[model samples]
Target: MLESLTPFETVLVAGASRGVGREIARILQPNFTVKALLRSNIAVNELEVLGIQPIMGDAMIPEQLDLSGIDAVISTIGGLPGDIKRADDEGNRNLIDAARKAGVKKFVLVTSIGCGDSVVALPPRALEALGAVLEDKEKAEQHLIDSGLTYTIVRPGGLKSEPATGTGFLTEDPKISGSIHRADVADLVCKCLISDRANQKILSALDRNQMFSASEIVEFIP
Candidate 1:
């Protein structure tokens, strides 16, 4: 097991502005000092209100990042509707390089399902719809896996906006396609950041039969 994180430990949560990223910072803030990297001033101010140390920088430019004393990092970095391939790949590459330069040891990447050869792991039509996204996610995942750092790549299924209970299940080799609440995804990222079970692994997860607790989900993580 990884050492339990103390309140004094520092975490650099990249993309901690909205969606799963913001939620991850929220869950971890009560436990550790969290540095929230964001692009927008409004977003930075918003997280500042929640007691997160706001660091303004774009993932595409890692040289500007200064996580010198950070203990761990979790990146929910992603691209929007179009330009998914270029943006996501570039941003992730920058994050990986920056983490290495910052000397951060543990890294957790919030990637999507169907990355790498896992693209074909999805139904054909589904793959077609998300071809560009999956390809870029594949590149990013490979970069992390090859980074020579203790890393965990979380491939969460579809995301929804809902209340989180810190519950979910791993669906590695999932035959039944489904989604998970974004809040749950954030909690999962936070748990993985602190758990050795999540070290150096690629995991796919979604809500299956029941709402599994964070520890339970990590123990059974794929």
Candidate 2:
């Protein structure tokens, strides 16, 4: 049977406006005091309705992060296309520096599977498609890994907007990769935060059923 460790009192979800970050805040709401780090006032009302405290801040600006008194930080921030300066690379580094200063217990980073030495996890075409964006994510991953903070780096395979399948799994094998729902990633992030086993581990998140299959895994994600 699955179990949960003692939950942290306060947790911050950077990039909480949408995508994976929004889901992380939603999953952490039941037991933890969830804080949503948003860039503008656009998401404030929605986050408030979800029972999350919205903090107006931008991850791109490192100095804006007032991480004082926060227990943990889950960063799901990524860059948009065609931007010479990428948020995935520098934005995350800023968060790490701030987290280190605040003495946060755990910094959970949600990156993609092909980051760093895990390039084996993706096909050549995918890498070609991502290009510099993937490179930026790799740099961010390395920055977090080298920050000396207790961190769990989660590299998910292709992310789907589907609901939680409850079948997501984590593995150290970089060669293993596939598609997984964003909600499932949020579920695993919640689990990883409270589990001592996940500390300092660089894990790949994927649906177990899609782990191996040449024909299927290639076109697994849209």
Candidate 3:
């Protein structure tokens, strides 16, 4: 059973220009006052058209991130291969620090499956390919854990761009791994944003029918 939680009225989403972050921002826009942190003005128009306010700032720059009056934050920032300044660790650190400074209510971080203790869930080849990025993501996850804020760290498996399947769910099992749609990940993130059961927990998000193994699926319903 999940405890009742106060809903967050304002949300700031990092990495909302594309992928799961974009979907999360889109989902939250209708219900909450949604804001997106962008490194540049490229996606400002697009996000504004979706009823999301685009705040011009880079997550990698600490001073640029302003979380004042924001009740919650959702971060899906990542970096490219061989990039000197990866947003996976550094950018998330800045956001976490800012959230702490502003006294935000909750912080939800969307990382990959290979992060932290879930590394055993991925194949060796896949691990080799994502090792560096996963390491940075794990660091970010740890930062959030130690930040002393209400937080939920969601590590999704291989991400698909398809529409939400309505079967995406969350579990505390670190060993779970599978493919889940980006939209479904967004839905799960939104649920966790106000879920008392998800606070201070690290969860794996996946579709019920997309598991890579035949393990028992005990989902944490928010």
Candidate 4:
């Protein structure tokens, strides 16, 4: 279990219309003032129903993202198969720039396991299939690292939509590879948001029982 510290009162979440970003906004809604940056009006009603304020904007357009009043920021934005502009790098780059200009306290970016030093953990076939996307995510990761903001980069392994297994955890070991539920990734991201120890860290998230190898694991507790 992770200990909670002085939590940020207001948070802005990018990519909150769906996936892990949506889950993170859901988790933070009850305790904090949560805002989601959205490119469309489609999810506005749905997010408003959950007590999350939806800001109509696109992360890819720097002028559209205004983070002035946000205390913290979390981005799980990515690209689609036929997208003309990938959000994995360009979108995140704009967000990082906005966060820096807004002086946001912390930024939590959700990427994939094959990003950065974790590439060795993936099978060659998987790497071949996802090489382009991983390269883009790595670019986003590096952008955040170089942005001079307190940041936590979480590279989750293969993602599942099932309920959290509770066994999901994080490790600094980039060689670790496994599958984890999206809810579990949301949980870890929330924990890292308030954890000073997670600042400036790049960690991999996985389920203990779903690892691809039997290597010894040292879980990172924050």
Which number leads on TM-score?
4
lDDT of 2 by residue, 1-222 (tens): 223345468999998899889988987887788999888899999999999999988888987998998989999998865777778988899999999999898899998998887898788998898868888898988898889999898889889998889888887778877899998888888778888888888888888765655433221210
Model 3 over residues 1-222: C-alpha lDDT tens digits? 112236688899999999999999988887788999999898999999999999989888898988999999999999866887799999999999999999999999999999999998999999998899999999999999999999999999999998789889899888989989999999899889878888898999999989999999888976
Residue 183, model 2: lDDT of 88
Give the 10-residue window scoring lowest on summed lDDT in candidate 4.
1-10
lDDT of 4 at 203: 94
User: lDDT of each structure?
Assistant: 0.75, 0.84, 0.91, 0.92
User: What are the clashing pairs of model 2?
Assistant: none
Rank all candidate structures by their TM-score, best first, as comma-separated numbers. 4, 3, 2, 1
Alpha-carbon shift of residue 186 in model 1 (angstroms) = 1.2
TM-score of each: 0.86, 0.91, 0.95, 0.96
Error of 3 at 134 (Å): 0.5
Model 3 poorest ten-residue lDDT run: 1-10
What TM-score number comes out for model 2? Answer: 0.91
Model 4 residue pairs with clashes: none
> What's the distance in Å from true for residue 42, model 1?
1.9
How badly does each model clash, as a count of residue pairs?
0, 0, 0, 0
- Evaluated with lDDT, which candidate comes out highest? 4
Off by over 4 Å in 3: 1-7
